[model samples]
Structure formats: C-alpha cells, structure tokens
Target: MFTKSILTAAALAVALPFAANANDGQAMQAATLNVDASAFTTNELAQIAAERGDTRKAERAARIQAQKTEVPGVTNAGRDMQAAILNLDPANFTTNELAQIDAETSALAKAERIEKILDEKSGATVSTSGVKSLTVEYVHHGRDDA
Candidate 1:
C-alpha cells in the first residue's frame, strides 16, 4: 500500500544518517591501526629476538606485563614463569614487540613461585581434615623378591 511505502521511506531517512555515522566510525578505526607493516623485515626481527635472549626478553616482558597485572591476593608467577619462560619463537613475535603485548597481558607478571609434588601410588589412600593438607598412605603391592 502507499502508506506502507511512505513509512518505509521515512524509516530509511532516519536510518541513513546513522549508517553514515557507522561508516565514519569504521574509517576512524582503520586510521587508528594503520601500522607500517614494512618497518622491519622478518629476518631482522628474528635476529633481534635471538640477540635479546630468553632471559632479557622475559624480564622485559614481565616488566611491561606487570603494569597490567594486578596484585592478586595470591599469585605464583615464579612457577608459572619457570614453565612458560621459553625463548619465544622468532616466527610468531619479534623482540621489539613484546613490550606492547606484555603491557596488555600484565596479569601474568605477578605469579608467585609454587611447589608441586608428583606422587604416583599403586594402592593409595588419602584422608583430609579440611582443605589444607591431606594425610596420604600409599601402599605398593610389588613382587616379593626374597
């Protein structure tokens, strides 16, 4: 009907301005992230990453990351770092780029050292009074070599 067509035209008029605004937002976002992709060659980044070494890179990363990482009531970064602190693969990230990522992922810097016990038992029984510690009795049923 003509009424339906008129209502549609009115609605489109109202939405057209919003659509233009949305396009403008996208343009602004693209401009914000317009990084020069060719600043460093792949080989240059790899060499820099290697020269930085794992320890220095991790330390730098931790410092940057520390800003974003809030002080949790209890965090064991030492243990986590021990496991996670490996030389970053040069293929994925450049040494020059760790600071930004660390800044964003700061929560990882405040990890505390943790103690881990790996006990394998054959026939083990454990009893706990509460959540703190467990009284464990491990029995090993092995062959009797007399």
Candidate 2:
C-alpha cells in the first residue's frame, strides 16, 4: 500500500504541470473567443445574423447602426472598421489614426500599421513579450473594406 501511494504521488507530480498548462491553454482560447466575438463589426454582425436566421441579432445590429452618434472629430465608420480589425476599442484611437489603419488592404498590414502608429505616438516600443500567441480568424462579408 505504501509503494502504491508513492507511485500515485509521483504520477500526480508529473501530471499536475500538464494539467495546469491545459487549463492555461483553455483560458487563453476562451479569451481569444471573447475577443473575436466582440471584434465583429455591425455589418459583420448583421451578416452573421442573417446567415444564422437570428432575428434578434439582426434587429440588434440594425439598432446599433441607427444609434451611431458621431464623435466630434472622429469618422465613425473608419474608426469602427479599424477597431474591429484590431480587436480593440475604437475610443482609444483618433479618426485620422483609424483612417490610416483602415487604408491597409489586409489584416496583417493593419496590425503592423497600428503597431507602428502606437510606437510613434508613445515614443516607446510596445512590449507584447508576455502575451501568448493566439490565432485570429477574420471573416470577410464580401466588403471592399478590410
């Protein structure tokens, strides 16, 4: 019984780290999903609602579209598009900055431009060292807009 107990403890010691890593991975994936969900543009939401036959979502998208209050110097459309692309809040950036990002034809280009703009604005390199890499999937809704 003592030998069996020691073996079980040893096995648990080996497995505990793996279990912890699995939990971390799951948490990261959940966070990524949340970002992706929130990154959907109003048009994208509308398209998704239509595809899923979800009237409530469709109506909500419509309401969001109708309720857009333009910021004083910000172009709402460009800001919103860049915000969705970067999985970031639109309020954090200015209209001109978002317009530059939106002008990028691809997601990767946009991300790079954002990083550059941030570096230029802050005068310091943004550190992403501790951030775990996540796969982002972008869905194009047959729009010319990136």
- Candidate 2's displacement at residue 118, Å, is 0.8
Q: On a 0 to 1 TM-score scale, where does candidate 2 land against the true structure?
A: 0.32
Residue ranges of candidate 2 with Cα displaced over 4 Å:
1-82, 127-146
User: How do all models score by TM-score?
Assistant: 0.22, 0.32
lDDT of 1 by residue, 1-146 (tens): 99999999999999999987764543443333332223333333333344455676445444434533433233344423432443222222222232333343333331110111011111253322111222234566897795
Candidate 1 — number of clashing residue pairs?
A: 7
lDDT of 1 at 17: 92
Error of 1 at 115 (Å): 47
